[model samples]
Target: MEAGLTERSDEKGEEEYVLLDLDAVMEHVSIRPDTPYVLTGLDTLNPMLIIDGKVKLIGEYEETIGTCLVFSENEAPVLHKETGPSDANLFSGRCIVDPNQVPSKEVKPVARLQKVLKFRLLLDGVDDAQQDHPSTEGNASNQSTATQN
Candidate 1:
């Protein structure tokens, strides 16, 4: 009867419960943990390769929708599409994260990274692209948006 979390017990003397702390009951319980989706080279600024046109990350920070990462030619896998820019200089790849998959310990770090990544958007002339495009005619300064992140 150690302290733990459990669902309501049933009749007929049956008590079904999940062991909250497996470490406390390892001797009696066997549970296989899931493989964590760890991002490679998290220490570096942009650390991941787009394999199969998709990249997953276990992040220490929140990634912005439009914030991008540039990879050298050797870093990224070959892509099959009408290419606008060469992966050789890695003309910036935008980030897309599934918020539901975020780890419990990394919420704050992701938020901070989101802020820093804003500057990268500005430096890449994305701000100018938006301004120059007639489609985005009356929008706020992209520089402000990046700095606000």
Candidate 2:
């Protein structure tokens, strides 16, 4: 899933994936200070792996601590981090970017189904219905359904 650039590259005859720049995505989402945006697609290989887009409070990390774009490999490792008490985070997600990749070259996450849905919703300033009680087209399937139906 692409999440860091708005366009794709044509390399090795590989289909370019849709990726939005991180800064643009954050600005579009209006991420506030110290807010951690939890994007779901990084945990699964499926196109629609991301269940929703959310912002949460997390312990400070040395990294920038925003939405990180994890690349995928043939086999990606689960992301397990312990931020605080009672919080055991485990992400067995796979993305287009290689997980083991040290990013010798700069790349971004492509727009997988979940990332696209989440980004569109975020651009419109809405969250998934399951998390947000106030519903305003929070359904990811809304667009896909509308297009199909």
Q: Global lDDT of each model?
A: 0.26, 0.32
Give TM-scores for every candidate, taking all chains together and pairing residue i with residue i. Answer: 0.15, 0.18
Name the candidate that leads on TM-score: 2
lDDT score for residue 27 of model 1: 50
Give the residue spans of candidate 1 off by over 4 A.
Answer: 1-36, 49-149
Error of 1 at 58 (Å): 13
lDDT of 2 by residue, 1-149 (tens): 33443444575653332222233245545544444333333222211212234532111112222333334333334443444454343433323444775545333333322222223323233333333222222332221111110
**Residue 112 C-alpha lDDT in model 1:** 15
RMSD of each: 27.8, 19.3
In model 2, where do residues sit more than 4 Å from their true spots? 1-20, 45-149
Candidate 1 residue lDDT tens string, 1-45: 212222235566634211111122335333234222222333444
Give Cα distance to truth, residue 87, candidate 2, Å. 63
